[model samples]
Target: MKTSRILAAALLAVGSGLALHAANAQQAGLHRTDLLQQDIGLPGREAIQVRVDFDGGAVSIKHSHPGEEVAYVLEGSLEYQLEGRAPVTLNAGEALFIPAGVAHVARNVGSGKASELATYIVEKGSPLVVPAE
Candidate 1:
């Protein structure tokens, strides 16, 4: 009986975590599909790649990662606002590097759909994305 109870509690905790993650993703307004995640050569670090799509006029919530990010535009134009820097716009075939822990937001500034291939090099065992204040 005790083992069953423990298993039930573990499942409940995992379920609750998933629910919170889904809620936050919906609030961000951007659709992200993770492509790959693996440990890098660097000690205690990892690399993650994701493709993010945004609807026309959609904006991503301000957030930061545990490490640096390299974003390559894959479709329509996108405007990025990074903390302490002027906003910049990029079109297909362009790319930008965002410093670690820098708060940033991306918006679909064009009239149609937009997408980006975002690659992150981050500390291992940490959350991939954290909302900025």
Candidate 2:
């Protein structure tokens, strides 16, 4: 029946829209690799290093670290945005420091892949990073 065909078409359209949205959402985050983590010999303190790779047009969700975080751009460029501050564009060899509990987002604003080395100094047994609601 025409009614049945119309219903199927509507469902298909909705399904396609959902699929596209999911794909875009997945593309909005950079790939992170845990490089190293070790105790800093201080009580309950630790250091962690991570390598993050961002494909062209990729971005990171709003997130925060348990303690201070420093990031050095390895290649390409990034747009770093922090709460209560203007966004900053960082190029290769540049670095940025993010204070504890500050929500921020990083994006690859260039036409190629961007890479960075992120180091975190945080309390042991605590998560290195956490997503902000």
Candidate 3:
């Protein structure tokens, strides 16, 4: 079970009420931009994660998620894995989907640096990684 823990837990307090870690702001960035998250869990966000990577290489295979995932190749290629299935290869403009609670692995697989964008949507408080499998 391999994974990366982003955070423990979060909570937000408003005018007359308190919200249980419901994100904080709207985020946007480019390649050289570090994974900037203004409000990691923007309020009213039903659960959405967007990742854009550029010139990616020398990467490791990591699995972290217990919910559905949709990925789009912005450039180059990507190699990924999911529980009970073989590895998959995706090129630029390509897309893939991952089921909930599935164990998966991913890395850049193209000869040159790879790039991609991924969006994961789920319930609030849901962990991005569930201790792998």
Best model per lDDT? 1
TM-score per candidate, chains pooled: 0.83, 0.77, 0.60
For model 2, the superposed segments whose C-alpha errors exceed 4 Å read 1-29
What C-alpha lDDT, on a 0 to 100 scale, does residue 2 get in candidate 1?
Answer: 100
Predictions: Cα RMSD each: 3.8, 12.8, 10.8
Better of 2 and 3 by lDDT: 2
| Model 3 lDDT per residue over 44-79, tens place | 334455565534454433455545678788788888
* Alpha carbon deviation, residue 41, candidate 2 (Å): 2.8
Lowest summed lDDT across 10 adjacent residues in model 2 is found at 19-28
- Each prediction's Cα lDDT score? 0.88, 0.85, 0.56
1 or 3, greater by lDDT: 1
Q: Which candidate gets the maximum TM-score versus the true structure?
A: 1
Ranking by lDDT: 1, 2, 3
lDDT of 1 by residue, 31-90 (tens): 878798899999999999989988889888788998999999999999999999999999
Poorest 10 consecutive residues by lDDT, candidate 3: 19-28
Candidate 3 regions with alpha-carbon error over 4 angstroms: 1-45, 54-56
lDDT of 2 by residue, 1-133 (tens): 9999999989876875565355335545567776888899788888999888998998887888878999999999999999999999999999999999999999999889999999999877665556688
Q: Look at candidate 2 and give me any clashing residue pairs.
A: none
Query: Cα miss at 50, model 3 (Å)?
Result: 1.8
